[model samples]
Target: MKHIIPYIAIILLATVIIYSNAEKERTRITERCQDTFSDAIRTEKKLLIKQFCMQYRQENSPNSLSVEDKKDWYDQNYLIATSPSRHQLDSLFRDGAHKINRNISTAIGYTFNGKNYFSGDESCRKSVIPVQECVYRKDTISTTDIALQAYIHIPFYVPLQNTYTYAVVLMASVALAVCFLYTRRRKKNMTGIPLQELPETGNVTPVIPRKVQTEKWMKLTDGYQWNPQNHMIEHAGKTVILRGEALRFFQKFIVDKHFFLSYSEICRLYHLKEETNGAKDRAYHSIKQLKDNVAELGIEIKSIRGKGYKLLFSHRNRQII
Candidate 1:
């Protein structure tokens, strides 16, 4: 029984050793595959590597390879060869003979049989010769070896399948469409002038030097306006008339005083200062007109609730001519 036990132990040990050796050989083959084609894969032709693995394995290890060995041989080579490197192929090859550690790689051209080796080749001799010298020199040959040609073509098809450029074009087209719609609305509004008849300037009385000073004061006021050029007290436009009598009165007050006044203060001077509409319907219409005119230029009139309406100019607006 004891003798049988020892034999069994020996059998297990042999099995372990055989497993380890097989694993090492598989790893070595994978590394050799990568070193032979790393430059080709990185140059964006990875299909060549897959083809090389498939053809090389079928020819060299047909019946011997287990499922795991077959998968590892191809997958490992694909990963290592396709990885991005700090330097490009032209630069790495130009450096002339770089050594990758055996822990990370297998010796180049160490396959079961060298791809270019012929059975009767004198240089190889088949018996005592090292495999390295007998293998075809990659530096001298620009063409891919027969085994790798198909695998290296995979990257070429990747860019054609990409959809990002189309998405960018779609977004740009949508933005252009929005701008076109807004411009059409504004042009329509501009052609039609509201309240074109001149109101009586009579009994409105001339406030001379002060009126001239008010014109200058309007220019220095801290506010943005849709038509700053036409905001002078003397200037008249359709926008001002549609605002009812309050805007005209507000203009009269500023001209009479020779300076700018806040909206609420202007409302008070015109006796339409209350938020209620009863005595102040003119003031409400005036404020609405100002907001609408600025809106045409892509600007907004934002009311500060307790304060007053402020003309907010958008940076995107084209400066009014």
Candidate 2:
């Protein structure tokens, strides 16, 4: 459990980064859509106005009119030509805007010749659209007399409907793969006979051969030797004196022939008051020092956290003598 925390944290961090980048890319795409659509609309308006002015000039024969009258005629014609009805604008948006960009969802609106027109559906017009990364573009259709305003809303990029499903499947696959590997590694590490399997009866101890007991030196499975009489432990050909509270704490394993010992039991054995300030800290320090001292012996003291400690030796029962 402790080993998997870092992996989970890394996966979470990667997910955050991926999501942030996706949003940024979506914003960039929306901005590009705004620029593209704005230009398209402006171009279309210009062409329509040019065509209207040509038709008006041909039909009205402005050469017979005064300067102010000619200005009024041009203005009225421009307004009449550019200000299409709401239905016409809606049809234009439905037919034209959707083809402009495949990634962006668009809505268009206009206030033309004192009339309002919208290209969005009823729900879109009524509901408040959240503006995160929303792109808005407005253009003015102007003649010498009047101007009509046109606006467009380009929403952030939305991926295909299947994208979310694929992402979920991919993430689940990765998590399952990590969990599978961790379980396999844990199972592999447990192949040897566990040192915790001592007899539960307090009166019996596991038998050690006569050669081991008579030699005055007991050899652990991993090649460490302990001499109880001399109070010395040797590991990897180096010997360290084992004494004081640490020695007493370790001696509990021999006395009980058990792997687990609670903190209260160790404190009682070592005559340390458990309620005293820094008592547990001192005990932890002693355990750490003991661990460092015995590292080369292939023996480990694992703290069970909120419980107690367990001793583990690397090899199986073959070298218990």
TM-score against truth, every candidate: 0.20, 0.36
Which residues of candidate 2, in runs, are more than 4 Å off? 1-7, 51-82, 86-103, 112-116, 126-157, 160-179, 190-321
lDDT of 1 at 200: 69
Against the true structure, whose lDDT is highest?
Answer: 2
Give a tens-digit lDDT track for model 2, residues 1-321.
Answer: 656775676577656755666676555444344334334444444545554333234355534333433443454345346555434333443344456545444555544455554556656664423221111112112323232223334443343223653575477568768877987898798788575655667586779877554548876445667788877777768787777556866767545455677878766643555633233444554675576566666677878877677777655532342
10 residues in a row with least lDDT, candidate 1: 145-154
| lDDT tens digits, residue span 1-321, model 1 | 432554455456554655555455444433333333344223433433435434444555435334443453344344335542312332332222223222221122222223332222244333322212211112213242112220111122222232443444455556556656766686688776664666766586667774443222243132322223445322223132223333454344334323333556645643443543222333333554554444543445444555444443454432321
Please report how far candidate 1 places residue 102 from its true position, in Å: 99
Total clashing pairs for each candidate = 9, 0
lDDT of each: 0.37, 0.52
Worst 10 residues of 2 by lDDT: 131-140
Model 1 CA deviation exceeding 4 Å by range = 1-266, 272-281, 316-321
Cα lDDT for residue 78, candidate 2: 51
lDDT of 1: 0.37
